[model samples]
Target chain A: MAELFISISIWPWLAYTLAGLVQVTLIVTLVAVGALVFIWLERKVSGRIQDRLGPTRVGGRFGWLQTLADGLKLLTKEDLMPEGADEFLFRIAPYVSFCASLTAFLAIPFAGGSYPFVALHMNTAVFFVLAVLGLEVFGVILAGYSSASKWSLFGAMREAAQVVSYEVPLGMCAVVPVLLAGSMDLVVIGDRQTGTFWNWYLFHDPFTFITFWVYFTCATASVNRAPFDLAEAESELVAGFHTEYSGLRWSFFFMAEYGSMLAVSLLASILFLGGWNGPIPVASLLGLTFENGFWLGFAGNVLGTANLIGKGVAGVTVMMWVRWTLPRLRIDQVITTCLKYCVPIAASMFVGATLWQYAFPNGAIFPQSAAAYQVREPWNAKAEAKSAEAARVEKTASREPVATEFTSGRTAEAAPLSARTPDPAG
Target chain B: MEAPIYWPTFFFLLFSAIACAFAVAVVVTPNIVRMAFYLVLSLAATAGLFFLAGADFVGAMQLMIYVGGTLVLLVFGVMLTSQDRFISMKTSGFELGVAVTLGVCLFVVLAYCARSIPEWHGMKAKQVSAVPLEPTAAPLGMGLLGARVDGPDRSGYLLVFEIISVHLLVVLVGAAYLARARGKKNLLVE
Candidate 1:
């Protein structure tokens, strides 16, 4: 979109800014709409599980407008601040949490092809997502502390310990897929798992299969869902860190929670499940790959996006099911489960997967050939081409003598870096 | 007409300003919790600077380990040590004056050193803007695993990586020991 404006003689800065705004608007809409849908889905799923009709009256039989109604109610409610609360911290905590949750989405690719759809493309996207996700705990802790309530404090403390502990194993679990794919880029990881379900990292090896479960457990715990939701144990800590929050401010925390839940689920789907790739290569079979024209490539991407979202939503549904069905673990149990079970299992699986990869370099089940396993250099190729073009332009611009020779020298230096650093697999 | 705004430079200025402002806020905030919060904002903005400098991996690590992990530990410590009584500890005027003078001196020295670097200055705006956003993850991973993939002459970080891993293990053990709850018998033993 920015390129379009730039091509049409608009100022580069304005075009870029407008493009960025559009991108942010799209992402915010995705989160907000996803949250609304997930809330409604959760109620419906929970109701069905308990053999009850959830919200039948709101938006016809399914009550699709329930979340909308809830949002309106929340907006109208008095935004209450605790008497002894730190006003600034209390006001900003939810935004911090929401922003952290939202930032993780910037690195997440919804689809993969010649031009994958992502807000920002980071090479270390998995790590970036995990890191941003971890920042959400700060907001929780601040909310707990600033609320000046004992229950809130307890909830925050529990969250602090739980999230910090869970991250260790969660990280370890995530690395197993990175190990399998041999790249930290989530798009690359997702692309490597293309073709079929068997190609998914979860089914790649026995160790990875086990690692996926461990990843899910730690992911669930990391997101503070039951049975690991000791941070918000309603029976004991009222509403946990959010005990003092009311109305829209309270809803923001939930939005952050649901957003992170969806993000983690998406990450899980991308890492363990086939991501945008389904059980079968429907798009490829339909000749909708990038080799086709632009429209067909877009169609493929759309299909892929749908597939990825379906997997993510499925993961979220499972989480909702677990939340409804299982009993919340005690704080001690949560800690023990992470330390004793998840961490050890993840570590052992990591070791096992490493050894497994060493034994069968291609794969055990599918046994893809070396040629088939060749890492794609498309991103590098495009980057190199762009840098070369940029260097040529810089050279021409430098001939005018207004621009310094240092600029040309720097461009020349950058050209080699971009061109030569193709594949670091060796 | 005015010169076109360089977006990257504009963003760099924005991030740096936020980072510097929040760093000062961290020092100025009286409440310990508020100080920690400010420190987080400062560190996060610094991470943004790292990202702007095209060190995405380093930026993420800064966010994860420093802002996310270490600061959480600091906040936990603050919460455990003094919930209400020491929430806002007032520093002595003399100490504050000394700290300010020291900080000013350090900043001046750092700024002088930063400005002294020749390669850091006079880069072509076109060149800076044209640098491709390449994924540094692979080269970083390879370097960690004892392969100098980024450059032919450069050395790998294998030994340093191993040492860091060991150091992390030691730190973990130390933390576990320090945090271990004492029984009646252990108290007597102590």
Candidate 2:
């Protein structure tokens, strides 16, 4: 998009600014719309689970516009601040949370390949996303501290402990895919499993299969979702961190929650599931690739985007299902789940996966040597090969002239390291 | 026609301004919690500066380890230590003078080192843009694993990496031991 603006050659800085605005608008819209849809979906899902109807009168029989109606009400509602609350921190807390949650979407690619649909194409996208996502806790902490309520302080403390603990296992679980793909770039990881369903890292080995579940558990806990949402346990903490918040400000926290839920779900899909690649390579089968034509590539990317979003939504739905079905764990239980179960399980899986990779370097078993089962080399293969060539050229260029007999003898094989050093006379 | 605005310089100035302003705020603020918040913003702006300087990995690490992790822990510690409202710690004039002297000396040394490098002097826009975006992750990984991919003539930092990691592990173990409950004294003796 920036390239398009630059090509026009009209106020280049303005073009860059406009391009940035467009990207920000797109990501913010996605987060807002996602929050709306997910809130409605959550209510509906919970209603079904509890054997009741939710928001039947808001928009229609199905109440499709329930979230929108709720949003409107929130906007019109009074914005109140506690007399003891720190005015500045209290006012900015929700925006901080929302911004951190939204910024994570920048590095996440919605599609893969030569033309990936990412706002910011980062080499270390997985790490960047996780890092930014962790910043969301600041908002909660600030909100809690500034609110001057004991309950809010307790909630913030619980959150600080929980998030800090969960990050350990969460990072370990995330690294398994990075190890398998030999790259931290999400596009590279996604491109590796381009062929079929079995190519998904979740099914690559028994360890990773177990790791996926562990990752999900840690991810769930890290995002503060039930059955691990001790930070905002309503029955005990009375709305927890955001107790003093109301109106649009309170809604920002909710949006941040759903935004992070969607972000982690998307990351999980890209890491463990086939990412933009479908169970069956529908785009490939239909010959819709960049190699064919521009339109074909566009179609392929569109399809890939749908595939990724579908997988992410599926993950979110599963989270919702779990949230509705299971009861929230106590604070101690939540910590134990992270440290005792998730951490140990993730660590062992890391070791097992490393060993599995060594034993079966091809990333397949039972049907080894089959051309179809071979993992595709990452997109950086060409660059690496070029670098290797450059290294070889450098080595040859630096070689010193030796005695005639020695040179003749060593011509068949590569010269020793010492002899390769450049002489004063070339 | 000349471009109206240079984007990189604009962003660099913006980030540096924010970092400097927030850092001042951190020192000036009387409220401890508000001071912590200012420190967070300052550190975050410094991370932005890192990103602008083409150190993406370092920027992300700064955000993760310093701004996100360490500062959160700092806030948690502050909260635990002082639960009173509007708590502030006042420093003596001697302490402030000492700190200012040390900071100035350190700044002078850093400025001298930066000035010693010929390449650090005025660079043209063309020179800046001529350098293509290089992926630092692969070479960084190789360097850590005792292989110098950037320049094969140089030795890798694998030993240093291992030593630092082990040092960190020892520190973590020591911290855990110190923080552990005293009720398990009998078990420890056993």
Candidate 3:
């Protein structure tokens, strides 16, 4: 580790590489930290809603250290296994949940303009995030089923049904923004919304305006938040899926829950709201050009990072308030709400957005659309034209033309191999 | 999109171990709930295999629909049917003996075919080329939308995509219908 750090210190490429690793480590840390904050926040929110003071002693004012204390206590407790439980499945389930939750962070872009700020930068990031998020239910199911308790099994069943039912509308709502952006890339979606608050897709078109609410409802359900948290409905299920789980294992599930809540919120900010894009175009106005402006871009990125985190925190706070203020829905009611209401609404909004995008291809419904926020350096028309010329040369040199593997062999690039393969003409 | 063989080799080995072990446990475990649990693990690991083979869509589909959806439904079925923790339906020792012998024979034949195939074993020590990792969303989205706008133009996988969409809708309806309790009879009648 020391030698590796030394090399990173010496070489600029190594510094960049180290920076990339730090970005990933930082996201994981943020999720861990966010989980701590949200759990505390949940308690406080629930407390105020229920007419009580929650966690006032730990870490001064707001009980900021309360989560850490709870975590330590959980760690010290005995790891229990119930009779008739599948040992391997029981042991592995929580890790699976945590893994799925953390993996979704890979595709989320915290800042719009920069290198290594984003974890995955997948072209299909929105889909990828949604897809991975769906996997978290398996762990919950496993935990409940393997617990050998009726309560646990019941909780798992409710969650399974809820997640599956909600995914239809959740997917529909997610696609509305994708349609408006003309790309599935989350960064592009965020950048497209980079001028004023009104530029956010929530105000883009009438359909998008409506789509935001549908998305929020579906997202809340997807994360098993209030009005839809029938999965872990404590009053009904007697502690639900984790009824048999004590100590560290139980905490893992909550951490996973908080992590997912934050993830969905971050996704919301990126898709419906302006992600890292603040209400003002500060970075662009300050002249953070791509070339010969690395430090300025870096500083802008740091500011955006702070902004994104602030937005994410604000979203989690809103969700907490909703959870506390609203009553939990029955499992049937939860599924009914998602399918009967959220699904149809999201579908209608999607169709409306598609028509709107079709009609107004480049029409700026808000100021952000024309804010001149940073675009990706490569993949522009000039570069596209150059690559087109290169393709022409390749076409003449071959009897049967190939798919033109120009950037494919170049290996390390921000974009995926699939992106470069598609001819402009096609 | 050649994954460094390190990934596939490690993944294939892990997948084979988990899948084989879980499959064996499924047969050996007396309790029905235990069998169901083993089956979920086995299928979940197979989803990982799908991911390793670069079928991200299929992997997610398996997780979201099969393991996450179907398996959860199956677990519910097991819970609903079971009156006891270990719900064992016994098969005779003679039946087990015969099945094991036959299974071993089939495995040998399968292993021979897999090991002997030139294409399968051709890249014994091949350098895993890093796949130019772009966001597969657009092409995948386009492919699903009946457009062959990217990749090796074999006219897109829109048919498969649409087929799955219809299939999932049907599956949801059929499974709900099948799993629903009749007014006169319980759903899990066993």
**Cα lDDT of model 3 by residue, B117-188, tens digit:** 778763444344544433344445545654433433345455567578999899979988986768755546
TM-score of chain A of each: 0.87, 0.87, 0.83
DockQ, Cα level, model 3: 0.25
In the range B28-129, model 2's lDDT, one tens digit per residue, is 778888998999999999999988888888888888889889999989988877846757888888988898889889989999999999987868888889
Candidate with maximal DockQ = 2
Return the clash pairs for model 1, or none.
Answer: none
lDDT of 3 by residue, A132-196 (tens): 79878878888887787889888988887788788889899898887666566778788778777
- The DockQ-based CAPRI class assigned to model 3 is acceptable
Instruction: For candidate 1, give fnat to 2 decimals.
Output: 0.43
TM-score of each: 0.89, 0.88, 0.80
CA lDDT scores, all candidates in order: 0.85, 0.83, 0.75
How displaced is residue A160 in candidate 3, in Å?
Answer: 1.8
**Poorest 10 consecutive residues by lDDT, candidate 2 chain B:** B145-154
Off by over 4 Å in 2: A366-426, B1-4, B92-119, B183-190
Candidate number that wins on DockQ, 2 or 3: 2
Looking at candidate 1, what is the lDDT of residue A418? 31
